[model samples]
Target: MPANEKLKEKISHLPHKPGIYKFFDDNGIIYVGKAVDIRKRVSSYFNRSAQHNKKTLKLVSQIKDIEFTIVDTEADAFLLENNLIKQYQPKYNILLKDGKTYPYICIVNERFPRVISTRNKKNDGSRYFGPYPSGTTMHVVLDLIRTLYPLRTCTYNLTPENIAAGKFKVCLEYHIGNCKGPCEALVDEAEYNANIAQIKNILSGNLSVAKAYFKEHMAAAAADYQYELAHKFKQKLDMLEDFQAKSTVVSNTLTNIDVFTITSNEQCAFINYLKVMNGSIILTQSLELEKKLDEDDTDILASVIVQLRQEFESTSREVITNIELRLPLDNVTITYPQIGDKKKLLSLSLKNALYLRKEREGRQEKNKEMSEQRELRVLETLKKDLRLTELPRQIECFDNSNFQGDNPVASMVCFKNGKPSKKDYRHYNIKTVVGPNDFESMYEIVTRRYRRLLDENQPLPQLIIIDGGKGQLGMAVKALRDLNIYGKIAVVGIAKRLEEIFYPGDSLPLYIDKKSESLKLIQRLRNEAHRFAITFHRSKRDAGTLKTELTDIKGIGLSTADALLQKFRSVKKLKDLTLDELAAEIGKAKASILYAHLHPAEGENA
Candidate 1:
């Protein structure tokens, strides 16, 4: 059958039930679409008068084949459509790219396991809590868990050999009462597992039960005359109580659902989702995408449903029934429930979404205005401060750092329109110059960075900023001139004490007008570059320290050190291994003698 005839036959077979349908081209590129009535939705496309937009028209023309899944209801269709779109990443669909899976608190299925944040959510007999908004939030919660439970966070495998060798010792966390020190066998397995169960309860919102258990344990410790243990439990109980007091309370009437609201401007549309779980507002995610509307709200809602379902599929609860949209759901039950907490939650979510949309729009406008004002101010300031010929739109700042001239490094941070262009940030390791010669290092770094830019056919920055006055700027200018790239780039220097700005040709220091936003922005960019350079330098110094310790060994070089560290994970782990094992891991011939020093029981002479 011909492609158009196949699509027509499939459309004829589509049911009147609420569901999602997909259109595929000759190349098998799928375009996902949702509808309240699949028959009506699919049939409308065959009508030329109904085609309102270029995209829709294009979609109609490309429909070589059609397919759909029958849904129980419109709500199910809305959800299932999202899942398919996310899975398929249909070429025509507006995809929301989810970066990393959000962190979730996991209680591992071990006798003395720890509470930790994991991206992977598996049904491995361990209870999981969250899909927390961010890693920082997860870290904060993990810290609180440690404070409350005092469970061992270590991944120390409980093997017979390690136990017999007395290799396990109580860590600082245990000594400080943040952990119960299971590695040293200070706590029995049953007791540890019981603690984990209590933690799971606390995380799952049964805080009252968790608190009662803690209190009972504290009383038992006190009765046994274990004052130290009693005091530790008391502290944990107090912290949990404090946390409960501060957390927001929700009404019992609200159900788990996601409420969506959309607001649009000329250029883009903002779609916000308010995720409510167990009557509490857990998170809000807003997506800004290209606007396309010619008065079909159902079509818009359909598009959003297709887009959003993919986002919520992985971690959100399966009990989601309510989805409040700006548009009517037609045959799908997009309920605007009147009266009760569900209605109130939906109202609040919609209001928040609209407010946020307006706020973001306002901020963008304000930022544009601020950028213009700052640019004019920077021009005036530059004319006065550096006595420049004209206002430089593109200013480049350079800073260098080193350890007593050892492991020298530099970084270039760029600023355009009074904002840092972090994409333009570049790093350099000082290869030619040695020891405390800041000017030479600057010249070399700047030359190399710009030379590569030139080779790549990239435009030169209008202004150059150096960390020091006159001498540094002059050296940079000289290097530029030597490379026949001098006049195209202007050089400025910012000094430490007076925060004075200097130009390449001029000997005197210059200062910007006080409290200028442009000056603040430039300083921030320069400081960021300085920080980047110093951080890189410190990492190099640390690596050098490691090399000094390990590289002298016959088989150990930089690559070998890296391999050992990658395999063992830490210096402590590397130290714990016998020399023969390390040699075997790295395939080194000096294994036997190294084993003698590390494990004298082997009897080979070091």
Candidate 2:
């Protein structure tokens, strides 16, 4: 087929809506590009441009065909483009590789759903909230959910047998009353379901109902002469009220509607969607794109309206009643409701979108400024604290863990330009260290990490951070010196509390200015490293304790064990299956054996 004809054929299927498109070679090699109207964007390639760069001309020439995804808005298109380019590493795209996945809060669908941090959103029965601006923001919401709701975070399936056998114990969350101990049968199913209902209500911004219920409970407790219980209920009620006050209400115009606004500049576009349910703002979402706008504001608004209407048709119960845009939306009833609640809601959403755009721009500027400021501060602080000559652009931190010096493990986390470079994070199972020998463990970890770097001719870090005092710092320094890398890498240590910063040879630790941004950056990095190390350690510990009832089944070998575990993440889930269900899930013979073990009455043994 002729190239232009082939391109036209590809463009024929493209939606005349807002989205980004990609150009690919015959070998499926990608060249990323963005456009508000994908059909127009891809069609532009066929246009003869005299000023085209050699690379661009070459890319355009080799482009076998183009593929486009229709997005709700141009902003959504941009974000999708960024995500795809990051994933595919297209040859012709400007690749700024950052090893960070946008964080999402996934509420897993199960008997008792868990709210946890995830990077991937699959078509599972779960609801995902975010692409949070930062981990801190995600954590704050997660923490609030944990505190406010009696929800289970455990992946363990709760069953009657498990509760009776005491196989499922009350977790720390239960002790603190964050969980209602459903696993242990301490809370009835009705009450637990009620709690879940309240959580959903809270998430949907029905704060008044939750607050009112708590107040009623508080009054009842007070009348019943239970002052402590009454006080607790009152405290909870107060917290809900405070949360309601802080929330910026976006709409009172209508319930169950989403308002979308798109703002575009030459370099990037921003699309913000505010979800209004029951006349209150439930959630707000924003997307940033790398598409340039060519059309007038009204035209852009029209494109957004068409695309959004399509996307919403699949999810929303009814068609959108109205669209409020910066410019006139021709087909829709584009009434800028003046002087009432509807106006206030529209104004709030627009303001939010603009504020978010400015904030994002400001953050980029601040990150650049802070990077330079931090470089100087790190250098000056390292000079005084660790006797280093310059600031470190890259810092690698090492942490070691062992349970009473058994199954010793170590991890190395990296920070580049004051942000975590997760791609460089490394883990080690300590081979050389004995029980309680943290100093030796530190040495082993450092030496192994740097030795590999040396073998690969990789760049050495400007500074090495150990999660210990002078002794641990000294161990790391000695390891570097042994590798003849001591001068190349400045070594420092961070001790807990007193926030003491230790150096290799210094007897006393140094302290940075409490309010310094550099110090805050270091603290954040240090805490993340510690958290990662602890998580790894706990996972190792859990793996060691992993037991399966399926092990008793005669025919169930390693492969079968793996299959069963994959099908059912926990033994409780496996135990929940009947003989027929097991047969459906696995196979007949395997199910027979499992049934014999679980329900002997239904087995051949009976």
The number of the candidate with the highest lDDT is 1
Model 2 lDDT per residue over 194-290, tens place = 7666766766557667787888999999999999999988888877766665555554456565566666665555666555666655455565555
Residue-wise C-alpha lDDT for candidate 1, range 1-606, written one tens digit per residue: 334565777878889988888888858746776677999988888865464577677767777778888888776776777678678877677656555587788888765676888999998998778767678766766777777766777888865566557888888988887777777677787887877777777666557777898799899999999999999889889988776654433565654556666666665666666665545555566666654323233445556654554444423332122344433334333556677766666566567657877888899999989878967786667655555676667778899897776888999888776667888888888888868899998889888988898899988877788887788888898889878898877777888778888866777776776586556756886798899899888877876776565666665567876665455444555556655556667665555434443455556442
What value of lDDT does candidate 1 attain over all alpha carbons?
Answer: 0.71
Tell me each candidate's TM-score. 0.51, 0.43
In order, candidate lDDTs are: 0.71, 0.69
Whole-model lDDT, model 2: 0.69
